[model samples]
Target: MSDTAIEHYWDTLVTPYELWAEPTSARLASAALDLIAPSTGSSVLDVAAGTGALALAAAERGLHVRAIDSSSRMVDRLTERLGSLAGCSAEVMDATKLLYDDDEFDAAFSVLGVMYFGPATMTALTEMVRVVRPGGVIGVVHWARPVGGGPMFLPLARAVERLDDPEVGTLEIPVTTAYLEGPEVEEALRGAGCTDVQSETAVVDSPTPAPETFLAELDPFFGMFPQYRAAVARHPDRFRALVAEEVRLVERGENGHPVAHANIAYGRVSH
Candidate 1:
């Protein structure tokens, strides 16, 4: 996909994404940071750092954080949120085409980003590995396919596919679905020159007051593609019903909050 399209898509969803996706991404970023373990004086890079969630977390941990995203709006938000953070900076840049020198960072990571690059996923990973020092860590978090079933977004995706609009019908499936399995993530990390790779599913309990609220929060994904938006606009009631049914299928927690699962895939760069 063109950078313009990707930027437009994300720019359109930035508000809702910040309100909804940031919480889950923050949790995942924390997990990745724990695995990375960058100390004071460490230089870290946050690729595709939408709204600076991971970058802020790293800076809070005392790492010098440099964050980048393709969407200028996202970068602006990140910059705004990063105001006066002495060691943090945000820039508009593409993950696949990083502007830093080799071994520029002590560690690099992305949370629920980079995985959507389709054929460019490896290119982005390669750039991440290239920029970090040989012994640094590379961490990623992506959506895991439900065991014995499709992803949580499959119902919505199927609805989009049924629209038969050529633009939407041919939209590439998310790269995470093909690589969230431990073995797949491990192989990709290894392929990017990471050694001692490790990956696991991290089940995050996202508790919303009700399913409707949960569905609303997920607008970032469901309303991502233009065709999907058109479809939703064409059949708002049907879309709501479908989402309600899907949420109903989810197991509720003791506090009545629905749980969401994510996979954290990480590895150390080879020395």
Candidate 2:
């Protein structure tokens, strides 16, 4: 997707996007922070930050944060979030071409955003390498597996596949998941000049009252896929019914919680 297109899609849905997503993003941010282990007071940059999830996490640990996103609305939401945290800031900027000086930050990261950068993915990775000082940490957390955010969307994907509703034209699953796998991301990390590249998978819990409500909980994000938005707008009841029916496809854990996983890839700029 073009940067402008992505910006518009996210800008229009910022409110609901954060409503459910911010909490999960924040959980993943904590995992990223635990892996990178930067010292307190170090300068950290969050690339393509959506609503300052990682920024807020870093700030809570006494780090200085700068977050950027292509969408001004996202930056607006992010800035408002960082207002209480002194020495933190947000801006609207392109991730592939950072505006700061070389070796400017002690660490940098992007959580599930850069993989969607498409053709510019490598440029964004290299730019992260450039802005972080030699020996600084760089991390990116992405949805693990070929289906992206994993089975968290399985109900929707299954529903779309089963529906085959003519009113919705064609429903294509999200295409950015391939870039999110551990090896693919680790390759990108090393290709960008990062050393000691490592990868880890962590389970991110998505709690809901019942399995069927998964789509209801994350409808805004799926709304970005116009087919989903149109399908639901036109056939709210039937569409949700199909989503609920497909809930059987998801692999639930012992206590019946939605178990999604994220891949965190991290490394140091060669000393």
Which candidate number maximizes lDDT? 2
Tens digits of per-residue lDDT for model 1 on 1-271? Answer: 4667768888877786676667767877887777667888899999999997799889888889999998889898989998988878999887998999998888899888887666788999999999999888898877775321123454455456555666445334544546767678778778888998888777675433245664566666665556667766776776567556555655433222344566778888875
Clash statistics: count for each candidate? 0, 0
Residue range 77-189, candidate 2, lDDT tens digits: 88988887878999999898899999999999998788767778889999999999998999998887555454556667667766677777666666664566788889988
Candidate 1: give its CA RMSD in angstroms: 4.4
Name model 2 segments beyond 4 Å from true. Answer: 149-152, 166-170, 208-219, 233-235, 247-257
* TM-score of each model, in listed order: 0.81, 0.88
lDDT of 2: 0.80
Cα shift from native, residue 236, model 1 (Å): 3.7
- In order, candidate lDDTs are 0.74, 0.80
